[model samples]
Target: MAPFTPFFSEGLYQNMRRVCSESEESIHYCSFPQVEGERNERIEQSVARMMTIIDLARNIRERHNKPLKSPLREMIVVHPDVNFLDDIAGKLKEYVLEELNVRSLIPCNDALKYASLRAEPEFSVLGKRLGKSMGVVAKEVKAMSQIDILEFEKAGEVTIASHCLKLSDIKVVREFKCPDGLTDKEVDAAGDGDVLVILDLRLDESLYEAGVAREVVNRIQKLRKKTGLEPTDAVEVYFESLDEDKSISQQVMNSQELYIRDAIGSPLLSSTLMPPHAVILGEESFHDISKLSFTIYLARPALVFKSDAILLLYGGNTKSVHGLETYLLSRDHSNLKSEFQLGDGKITVDAIEGFPARNVVLGEHVFLTVGDSVLRTKGL
Candidate 1:
């Protein structure tokens, strides 16, 4: 009966609806869910800041015509004072990556340093304190150069018409006009208080591959819905890209196989160069996207991979593998290198030639086998 009846709650109610069962007709008849943890305002503030940063990133994506699924190379968060974000940014870095769909989140000290800034007086706040002199104060503010505004804000006060105006009376706006005159996709947002979020809109090879992966995942999910496949039903995926350049299609399939597999509930996924001759006895689906197109063949589970061959200790996305890749370069690579704990089990993969393969694990038994070296990991 609640407005936010969760799926889990609905399932529980359905199971208990029978008279023979010791359950109620509906979750509304049951007690409210118990609170197992306490809420902290400090944590709330940190999360709020993270959300604000995400919103800022989304704005840049929208303005540049880049969809949320497409990953950007980098996003720079600029706030002279990111009090709550300081710790959260370090602790919850992965959340930022997935939410913003950016390869990296760079928290910079001065995001506005490269761009021009204009300070406009928040007339409502100014009028209340300055009375009729608000107009005069705004004019003085408009006359001030970008540097002057920065200096004024740093001082936290400005003297206009001999009246001392505190920082509360002024609002700073960051403009995307680059002083260096090099053209780039750039945008800025004024976040809570004086924080400004600036995003660098450029996609390198690595980031472009990530974006392609996202597009493939979206297309596959759409195909699954069109074919009326159940969410829990595992299916075999055969992807054929419409892209003329085979390299681009292969690169996406290579880089984002794990993501595609997890998203579509498929244990066995692959991109085929040659199209299947005819619609097999298998239930298959086909679809095309504007930028990226593919045909996905879905088949009921027949066990694509042997369980004894290779197994993931934990049932999770490949992001954990990506994290391991980053860890190898950092000083804190010791603990995770031995074993990565996920779900109910743990996985271990040794690095080869200072790098791991794009698809760390495939099928069931075939895990990473790099260059002549095969690091056998145990499945718990």
Candidate 2:
């Protein structure tokens, strides 16, 4: 809430400078952005409180270097009144959750448990009212108990040292208590009156591990962009890890495969190997090789494995296309007596009569059947 300011006239130069202010906020009662609509004080106050929560959450993320791309596990909101909590954790829940990127929201009424709430008389506002007794009033205001403060908040007034005081005569200050096993740096807190927003800055391994899939999607989209692929263009996504088998990239691929596919509007291929006759659009590596390293390739959908009437490699895992079988097969391509090469192992048809064209394997004599056309891998 902002206090209204009355207009005052200074010298000619000062008045001219005020009229030529660069920011509207610098001038009082500037209403250019205001729409001609009915104003509801209740709704307006609700929005103001909601925005305060959001602002504090954002400040925590920025100051602590927690990027919005990464998600957190939980947020603890504490206030004295349950109705106030309901207004936030109920009416305006979705907006806060999305903005904070927290998986869960917990509300508590014990503000005194997490913070020390006290009142400090506004010396400027009090000096006009009490004149000589302002100093005595200030000490009693600081020494006021939590119960006394909460009670005074409702009526917006209290009496200290036989002098009646109003809420405007003082300001409520909240000093949050830091949790055990955590330093002040690890916790961030800000309040609008009694509304206390506490954010734990520790990173959640599970949430971040899941977030890796989002990073993969971002990279794949970048690769798609580098190759000048259009939004409607359907391509295949391939992930190859330079590290261990159960690598971060592989885990994200396995866990968030569906998310990756849906985000880029493409299918994630099972096999990391390069396919024949496929136009290699582009390949990108994670910029931070020290922490995470993986290769992502974007290419035009070059081939499909349709053996036993099922999809192959990594394509089998995706269930978006119905009526298509999905399987991962092991093979031994030993003892093919004839030498053959057609469409660079994408196709091979012998000179024999009345023989259907079958897909061939290059390294091993493996043939993939795709209805009338066969994408063959030649045994090398």
Query: Candidate 2's residue-wise lDDT over 298-321, tens digit each?
Result: 765543444434224224434512
Q: Per-model C-alpha lDDT, please?
A: 0.58, 0.64
Local error of candidate 1 at 66, Å?
Answer: 0.5
In model 1, which residue pairs have backbone atoms overlapping below 3 Å? 309-365, 310-364, 310-365
lDDT by residue (21-76, candidate 1, tens digit) is: 77666676788779888888777877777787777667767777888876766666
Instruction: Using lDDT, give the best candidate's number.
Output: 2
The C-alpha RMSD in Å for every predicted model, in order, reads: 15.5, 14.0
Top candidate by TM-score: 2
TM-score of each: 0.60, 0.66
Can you tell me which runs of candidate 1 are displaced by over 4 Å? Answer: 1-49, 82-88, 145-148, 179-181, 186-193, 242-245, 265-290, 302-380
